[model samples]
Every structure is written in structure tokens, then in C-alpha cells.
Target: MEGVAAHQKRKVMVVADPTRESAAALEYALSHAILETDTIILLHVENPNAWKNPIGSLFKWPSLPSSSKVASSPSSEGLGNGAASLGYAGGGGGGEMEFLEALKRACEIAQPKSSVQTERVAIMDGKDKAPIILSHCATLGIDLLIVGQKRTLSNAILGHKRSGSLRGLDTAEYLIENSKCTCVGVQRKGQNAGYILNTKTQKNFWLLA
Candidate 1:
């Protein structure tokens, strides 16, 4: 037990979105961070602009319900050309409900006995979401914040097709710089390379997983 850590209960918040990077973050947290005594908060910082701009990129997941206002499949082809198609008019803040649910299922599967909380915070106007996340961390007394890092090659190849108006990639790096709690940025480097992580103390630190 020389190198083992003492048991502690903490709130771990992972930003849940419809991107593979977000999924990778959650997967990393479950495998490396969360404990049975720790609570997991699946946070979704919704960018209203994703729905407002017809061409802005938003997530589409297979697990999403067919009637979901957001993308239900991994294709931008379904976005159409209006806010109505994206359900931007305001139904019940259920825009990302299904997507969050999928993340919840992943947490449950990873830690069956762990307590989990979920929330969706909307970014108002053109304000940056990093401050919103910090506010939530303060209010929730979070101990750790895990954000997903998008691959650079993917961005160069996919261009705006992946990021669009959401700018989630920027949000992740911002949290690493400004989060009050212990924040971590995760990027999957495939099965062989394990992972590349970013933290307040380390930049692009490679972990063997």
C-alpha cells in the first residue's frame, strides 16, 4: 500500500456531449479517476448557437431518440435549414436529454454502485462557457472536472464539419487553464498508444492507460 491513495469521496464532473471526445473523457474518468465513494456529474454545456445556425456543427449519436431535436445519427445531413428542425424554439430543455442519458448509462455501467448526477447548462448569447462551468463547479463543490480533448488531425481533416459553432474544443482547454478544482483534459490515442492527457500541472502528458 506504499503508493496507494487514501480513500476519499469527491464530486467528479465530466462534460457530456455528442462527440467521441466527450465519450473518451468519460471512459477515461471511469477507468482512472472515479471511485465507489465519489459522485459523478455529467454536465452538458449547451451552445444555443448550434441550433440557431443551420450549418453549425452539433452532435448526432445513434443512441439519441429519433425525435430528438439534436442530431440522432452521426451525420449533419439531418440538420436541414431552420431552427425548427433543430428544436431551437424551446420544448423542455430536452434537447440533449437523450444524449445525456447515453452518458449516464455509460457511467452506470462503469460504476454500478456510484451515485450519479446530471445537468444541462445553456450558454447565453456569445458568452464563453468556461465561466459557466467554473460557476457550476463552485456551486456543486466539485473536486475534479474532466473535459475531452479533440484530436488535431481530426480537426484539420474534418475542418468545421466536426466543431462547427459549438467550439467545444476551446472550452476543454479553457477549463484546464481556469478550473478551480482539479481539471483534466483527455484525448484518446487509440488502443496501442493509450491516452494523451492535459492537466493544470502537465501539458500533453502521455499515459499508458
Candidate 2:
């Protein structure tokens, strides 16, 4: 059994966005699911449309190399500070930078308490995020997939109109239906209950509450 476990190193992928829900998922994994030998990947999918829209300044396609190290400068701007420490590729818009910072911060907060290998990745493509996430799981041989669920005001209103049965968000729903590996969806517990890591100050701040 030890040999089998050694051969089957658990690979976990946490699909995160710039939301507290994503942080909650990572926090849960770090606290309970991850092992010392487990490998964790925090993945963010940049919307392809952002590149095409003239006004959309979120991210650009092929902006940086496939896997380039983030720059290390205090005022380098964007996610350079946190992402560089975590070895994330650079050359994205403010939104992308924010996403990277959030991912890096989550791992940082979790890293000190756990002995696990973690990395962050940004996918810039025109395809739907669900397919991209599913493809990564298949290609990377991920053993577990974790995602976060935070209901927006729109979602809440829609649910109220729909008799309290809310539809799953696109990414979570797709993974639940199609992923070959086990999937866990974490729901945020309270208002402003999540933590956000600031790339510039290298500090963490609690959200909402």
C-alpha cells in the first residue's frame, strides 16, 4: 500500500478566479485534503473575448511565454510581486495580475501550515473555460478537482424567480458533469469571511466582514 501510494501521488487542481469562493476552496484543500506529497495547481482562465474587445484591457493572448517567471520588483505593477515569488508567468492586464496575486496569496497563506508543492497557471484561450479545465485535468492526471461557488446578486435573484432552485455556474457545472476525477465544490460560508493576499504589501486582508 505504501508503494502504491508512492506511485500514485495525488495531484490536485483548484480552479480559482478573483473571488472569495475560490479562496475558500483553496483554504479547505490546504486544511483537510492536501498531503505533504500532493501537488496542487491553482488555475485561472482568462476570457478570450477580453483580447478581442478594443476596450477590454483585462489580458492579451500569448502576452507572455507559456511559462515565464514573474518579474520581481516592488513597483513592477500588476501581480509581479506575489506571482514572481510563486513563479507565475507575467505580461497580463490589471485583472489578470489581480487574479495571479489572489492565487499566489492563497497558496502563501496555506503553504506555511502545509508541506505541499503548489503552482499557479493562467490559460489564455478563446475556448470555453470548462473545456480548458477539463482538458487540463485529463492531461495532467489530476486526482482531485476543487472549485468554489459564490452566489452573485444576479444568481440570487434568478434563483428566487425560479422557486429556490439555482442553476450551477458554468465552470462548476461543467466539471461536475464531465470530469473523470473526483470534484469538490466549496461554498463560501459567511459575508466577508475570506482572506485576500496583497501582492504589494505581502500581507493578507479579510474580506467583507
Candidate 3:
């Protein structure tokens, strides 16, 4: 047993989102997975909007800080900065604070009894979520990636184009097909069919979403 990897803790990254499916997948991993021999990292990537001005490149601030007014407001309406507005408001604190709170809540519910440690950190500025995740895996020596599968209509209809925003696939497709590490696409609670984890025996990573 000593030479058989010793059941080392598996680094699992759960891509957190505002959807019920994501939550379900997270809970499943916690309850069924090796709690003492696995590390779960929950990450919430704020998507970039097409309308925000690229001011982060010219300024010292990493992405724009959210407005106090926007953060204080109770409404969840879209921001004016377009793409930048999509992720974390214009500022780092506004949108990020909320993301952290959500991540903590998710962990509390998913791994109530498990003593596993988790880190809820924001994606680096100007870096896409996919690449950031991959980089994090390499830096942290992660062994696996767990992502929630999003459901979308398979039929696009008469000449209607399929939207990329239908599910969480866009954020994960690249990693699924090209990651150096193993990636698991969790469609529902305990469901594991849309993709394969054995990197040596699979081709074409497909996530329903």
C-alpha cells in the first residue's frame, strides 16, 4: 500500500456558478468523493463583457473597481461597463466580495463534516477563466478538475444559431480538450457520462452545457 500512491489527496477544482446544477455537482463530489484524501477548490469566473472599455491595461488598477452605488443597490441589473461590467463590476471589491460569500456558502453546504480546505480567489485581471484555471492547476499541482454541466437545447431550429452562452461549456471546452491534467464534467448529482476522466483513452471532450 505504501508504493500504491498512498491514497494521496486529490486536488479537485469545482467550478462554482449561480446555477442549481453547479451546486448539485458540488454536493455530489463532497458526499461521494474522498473527503480526507481530496482537496476541493471552488472557482467562480466573472465573464468579460464586450462593452467594457479596456482601461485596466492603461491604469494601475486590475479591472475597474465597482461603483459604490452599484454595489449598494439591491437590484441585479447589468452594469454600464459592458464586458467588464459582466464579471466583477468595474472595481475589484464590488463583484469579488459577493463571489467569495457565495463560494463559502456553497462549501458550507457541500462539505459540512469534511475538514477539507478550500480557497475562493478571483481570476487574474485580463486573463480568461479557462487559462487562469489551467494555470492554477499547474501552479497548485492539481490532479483533477470538476466542472458542472449546463443543459441546453440540442436543437437549434430552422437556421437559428446555437448560442455559446447556453451553458458552462464555453468556459471549459478548451480545458477539456487540451488540459494536461484530468477533467471531469459533472452533469448532475453523481452523473458522469458526457466526458471521460481517463486521459489516455478518450477523445473529444463533450460537456452538455
RMSD of each: 10.1, 10.9, 12.6
Which candidate, 1 or 3, has the higher TM-score? 1
TM-scores for every predicted model = 0.68, 0.53, 0.50
Which is the better candidate, 1 or 3, if ranked by lDDT?
Answer: 1
Runs in model 1 with CA error above 4 Å?
1-7, 52-97, 153-169
Shift of residue 160 alpha carbon in model 1, Å:
22
- The number of residue pairs in model 1 that clash at the backbone is 0
Scored by Cα lDDT, where does model 3 land?
0.47
Q: How many pairs of residues collide in model 2? A: 2
Q: What's model 1's overall lDDT?
A: 0.67
- Position 158, candidate 3: lDDT: 17
How well does candidate 3 score on lDDT at residue 205? 36
Which window of ten consecutive residues has the lowest lDDT sum in model 3? Answer: 59-68
Return whichever of 2 and 3 wins on TM-score: 2
- lDDT by residue for model 2 (1-209), tens: 13446445678888865454665666556655566567777777666455544333332221111112223333333543333333333444444444456455535444433334444445565456777888888988898888865555533343212221224445664465567887765555453353332111121223332
Clashes (backbone N, CA, C under 3 Å), per candidate, total 0, 2, 7
